[model samples]
Target chain A: MLKVAQPDRPDALTWVFLGLGLLLLPVGLYLALSAPPDVNQGYLARIMYLHVPGAWLGYLAFFVTFLYSLLYLFRQDPRHDRVALASAEIGLVFMGLALVTGMLWARPTWGVYWTWEPRLTTTAILFAVYVGYFLLRGAIEDPELRRKAAAAVGILGFINVPISYMSVKWWRSLHQTQSIDLTTGKIHMDPAMLQALLFNLFVFTLLYLGFVRFRSLLAALEARKEEA
Target chain B: MKLPVEGWPEAAGQGRVGVVRRVVLLALRDLRLEVRDRAGLLSILAFFAVMLFIMALALGPEEEPLRRAAPGVLWVALAFGSTLLSTRAFALEVEEGTLDDLLLAPGGKEWIYFGKLLFQMLLLLPLAALALLMAAGLFYLPLERLFLLFLTLVLGVLGYASVATFYAGLLARLRGREVLLPLLLFSLVVPVVLASVRATTGLAEGLPVAEISDWWQLLLVFDVVYLTASALLFPVVMEG
Candidate 1:
């Protein structure tokens, strides 16, 4: 008989994860304090700092999901699987906030909240691809196979992320240009706005670490509860 | 690359079968199992019909445009539908623990993979023929491009079955693979789909093969890349 085992709880890493969680609160406040109103877009640009970092982290979180999914395949450990799941969940959170804040910011900036431009289109596809992964997981009954299959989906689906972006660029449509504007000598935002943006970036990264730890702990607890 | 054939216990135990009779006997047993239920033929045919019906409704009397679209439509529909069916070729074994039995038999997992791949390729042929008929009648596309179109479909199916079947092994062990298979497959297949669409559509537009050679070559390249990676990785992905 094949014996499948659960992962034991961590000691030092647990404390480190908790410490990172504690640090996020201060970092988040600094970003908000540092970010001043934009001379160009006014206070509205303040949202960009929160919104943009969230968008960047959204991709970052998903790629983490991909990496851990691969690691789980190699190690066959449930902890990595939980990490992948946690990253995916947090990625979604940030992605959602990014879109909502973008919409809110856009109501004044672009005169429209939703547009089918490449950024939006690619984002929509990313959203769809992940949703499909969840759906695929729901259909499987075996826990082990479920992890393996979902891992493959995580790896394969990354392909569309690029095409989804390229489709916007290739066809030449309504989507906005690249977000990282290096030209014009510098980013066209007020110093106050930059501080706030920077603060939000730090806050969110801390928040992400906190969430990943909490989620990992929950997964571990769930395992213990199941055993009991 | 040859392991010592010294003791059949350890060597044959490693999953290679030298006895022709034993391999043939196993193949016969597999064929019997497949024939007992007709699972492969049934699922592929069922989806093939559904795709044709939907395509007809979607096109709706636009025969000229339909003719050009037929190749792409057929290939995409076929690629997806075949994935649905071809995956199950080894599914029953996986589910019932027969897979372990086979793995412990004469040849190991690689032999099992080849057997399943071969079976699926054969099963897809008839469905492809049926789809070709539907494409011709519904879209009113001339069969004059039969050689080129069939060439594309054959290679496309070769690509589809090879990769799809390997992924099936990956999916076969998992629960809810019916949904996961298509998702994983479609992502990996975008490049192949692009090349196939280019080739089929270009030919459908009456462009000579030479004019469309670029797309054809791309499709061939994609097929080779997918096939090599799939064949090499099938063991690791499926077993490891």
Candidate 2:
């Protein structure tokens, strides 16, 4: 059952995360701007600072949704469902950011804004899956059924994240391979650029944490109002 | 209406064989009902014919373009047509208020998902074959490799139906499910569609089986993953 007794305001930790992330965002930008130019693409490659973090956080957020969806199914808790919903919503925003930034980067680099390469295609499908998640949530009138259905989508849709991440390796497409390959624990990036990218990733992750918490709190309030 | 599945109550108690029997009974019953109610099946077949004709007309009278387009056109039609049939899988149960009864049956609800999936596969496979033949004729698609093409159909249809049946069951009670099903389905099953289309094209091109096996492997992976995930989730989602 949903606990309508949840606190109405975002917690202190949320404020801290949001503040720290906001404080660091500009610094991250400065670092990204000042970072060494790519040996090939030059300063145009700076988009990776935003694009990589946005995509990574998108994957992370969806993974969180997946975990919470599973928890909701096993535990039958509306709180878990709310978290899943909030995370998915946040994930969509970050993923959209990644896609747009990637396109901007691609036009100057790959000479086309879009290609049907595996990584791009898989990522687009991943985006659509979450979009459908929200659509499903909106169409259902019953809260319980809506939650169950959304959870199922959340779980199933996360399947594409790994596929999207690995599509570069699997298909050897036009999209460049990961600079920081998680599977192989390899780093093929300059230390200064890697540092800036890592910092941006950290800041973006903080913002994501803050946003998800705030959104989930709002969802809790909405759920409480719906019950009232 | 009385539950069409005979001996379902005792069927669960018989262990491994019982689950298999229950699945077959439910599937066969649905198949019989679907066949008896010819309207849905006829419309889907008609949809395939009309769609293939329009596609051929739009892209065609030219052989090379149509041949290249055949696999994509065939799979897209199959994907769309199956959504119509997929909804019908649970629409009858929901209409008659028998879905709850099926859920209330004595054992695990996984079989219900499997049964509905089997029903979709059974219906879609033959229709797919017919659509393939239609494409072959209209689009200059080669079918000298009939057996390989059929293999592609089975793998592809299973991949598509596994997710479709699961989603149909999920959205069964909603008013706007018909519209929503395809939206959700197309996104998740793109890989399956992509692999199937590629495999079909390879077969049509007279590629070696070794070349086409990669696509087959991909389709098999999707089918197995979707089937397992949906089976596990079905009972949880269906429960009140």
Candidate 3:
């Protein structure tokens, strides 16, 4: 009979993460909502408070996925694979939120829900690649094979992310003359708005740190079940 | 007349010449197998033809629109066709259990990877020609940019094939990879697809060489990066 390995008990750091996330998120939300709106975009600009932070967290999550994947390949540790899997899952959720929020913001501003804007297009591709990563994980049964394959995808996908972004940028700029695209160049904001955005970014980073701890513990328990 | 083979260190002659020989042998074996079983090649060709016909119909009978859309249509078809080609390359090995045997071979797994990559490139050449012919016939494309178009296709397909072959091998052991391969593969190869379409479009429209150079450079950079990365990573993936 197969035996699952029991996950270790959660320690003080996990509790600390939970406490920080719980305390910071609501305060961050209060600041973001209370901050003055953008002069250019008005009240609608508040979406950026959520959108930008989510997007940053999404990128950060995938970066962690890439790091853990590389470590897994080098060290052949199941723990690294578990950490990679957890971060990728979180990254996908954040990216999906970012995409949706972006679309919502674009609707009133750009006059369309979707545009072939380089950033948007590149993010969509990045999101799809990770979705496929999860699908690949589901398709393989053997633990070692699955981990190796997922790590390969994770690493390659990370490399391709930048290449696709550059290609999209080149493709767009070459085809269309740079007429001051909405997302490019400089953005101006009131100092209060900047502070609010920074606070949210901090909160979201904490949320991600907390979420990954819980998720990895869940993964460890799952691995234990399989082992059992 | 041969000297005692044991006296010669195994590492002496088995350096570059040996790796090259192994790579060539593996590539030829795949190509030979493909030749013997023509179903895979024929199906892909058939798929290419049908895809072109569908594109033709979808764009209607207008020559001007068809001609303008020709570059995009050609590359899109090739991208899908190459997906099928690469997936089949590994799927056959997986089904036949030859993958394990190949992995068991001592050293030179990179040779096996290049072998598959070479096999994919070979199959792509004729398929691309056929697709080009279809585009020319259906879209009424002028042959003025044929040279540039050919170069774009070669580079674009090389980049696309290298990456696709890498993933195909990676996913070959999994169930339901048929669906997952293209999903993951297309996302990663978006750059290759975009560059190819743009470069081909520029050539077809007689854009200045200076303007087209950007696309050419992107394609070249992508091919170099992906090809080298795939070569280095293939051994690790196969070892799994």
Candidate 4:
């Protein structure tokens, strides 16, 4: 009952997501730039517009990978594995962007590009976990074994996401605590800044959705060509 | 003189205790094999000694620096040593072509995972203690709190081995697994290593139990999570 005849191109929804996300990106940027500066950090805080969304999507993307990986194990479906791979690849890029932007911000704010604080260390470890995920995927030659191994890595490696997210609160270390704490549902920022941040998050999520769909299609094509 | 698989049919009828017995028997069998083999065990021990000696030389000639660097060095040594051991967990099975035989046994496959994990703990704990003693000798690491330090060792090694055993099994049949195992393992076990190091440092620094308890709690959480997650996923991944 495997679905062999799949469409070669991304569907209408993928195009819509990519088109709308790109169209609204400049608007989101304008809002972030015009938003009132933080009382303490001033304009330096604007980087949060990019950094926060990047980190959020990174976490979101990995969570998706984790889910689809589980599904792949249970169902033995190539589509599920492809989705997991695409999500992980996208997650790595976004996580890398977040890390780079963070270092840029930290250089001016914390006097160094990197520090061994809890948040930074956990995030780096999280990044390394996915990098290993890709390495494991690449090293395996058998397709079924590769999918199984990658699924296991995808599931196990997700253990770091929550630890990285909560490291600031747990250690009370150098990193700033979440301004929009998900656990407490607390909003401790100016409304203007919050609005801009939320808009940027929405746009990044749209782009992530489009990217994953497109990447999965590319993966499916590769799989077909390998078979042919 | 029944083969392990020949006994599984009757053992499967025996339920939970049978599973427990199977786990222990499997672990002990592997342990017996490991002890008899000798080379793997001695090489790991020698690896620890040389590692600690070089680390001591690099950070030493001063007790204060050696003492300060002791916890980090000890745990890093243990981490590397365990990777060496973990690959051997399933290496012999694959080489012998008996892995498929083990899989062919009746009932849930989780016991295989637990059995391998137990073997790792049984082997790793003693080696870890010896490594701890070596660190104490060379790096001036304090031994007054030996019990607490050993507790950290158990929790940390369990966490590390749980994932390592799972990966070692997953990659057992693959070529280049020797290079790949550590690359996959070190990232996942960072939290365990970090907490264990912190706990050891606190004990060495003579911190009160209450302060170090936080690290112990973190290690325990990681141990439980890794153990549960690996056991649950092991069967699914190992299946065709």
TM-score per candidate for chain A alone: 0.79, 0.87, 0.92, 0.86
lDDT of every predicted structure (CA atoms): 0.67, 0.84, 0.83, 0.85
Candidates' chain B TM-scores in the order shown: 0.83, 0.94, 0.92, 0.94
Give the residue spans of candidate 4 off by over 4 A.
Answer: A1-5, A34-39, A163-192, B1-11
Question: What C-alpha lDDT does candidate 4 achieve relative to the native structure?
Answer: 0.85
How accurate is chain B of model 4, given as a TM-score from 0 to 1?
0.94
Interface RMSD to the true structure, each candidate: 5.5, 5.7, 7.3, 6.1
> How does model 3 fare in lDDT?
0.83
Model 1: fnat (fraction of native contacts): 0.20
Model 1: runs farther than 4 Å from truth?
A1-47, A98-126, A135-147, A159-199, B1-43, B68-72, B92-97, B106-108, B142-151, B154-159, B171-180, B183-195, B207-240
The 10-residue segment of model 1 chain A with minimum total lDDT is: A178-187
On lDDT, the stronger of 3 and 4 is 4
Clashing pairs in 3: A2-A228, A3-A227, A3-A228, A4-A224, A4-A227, A4-A228, A5-A224
How does model 1 score by TM-score? 0.71
Question: What lDDT tens digits, residue by residue, belong to model 1 across residues B90-175?
Answer: 77788678877766554334556666766676667767877888888887766778788777777777777776877777766666
In candidate 4, list every pair of residues with a backbone clash. Answer: none
**TM-score of every candidate:** 0.71, 0.90, 0.93, 0.90
Q: What DockQ values do the models have?
A: 0.17, 0.40, 0.49, 0.40
Candidate 4 at residue B236, lDDT?
A: 72
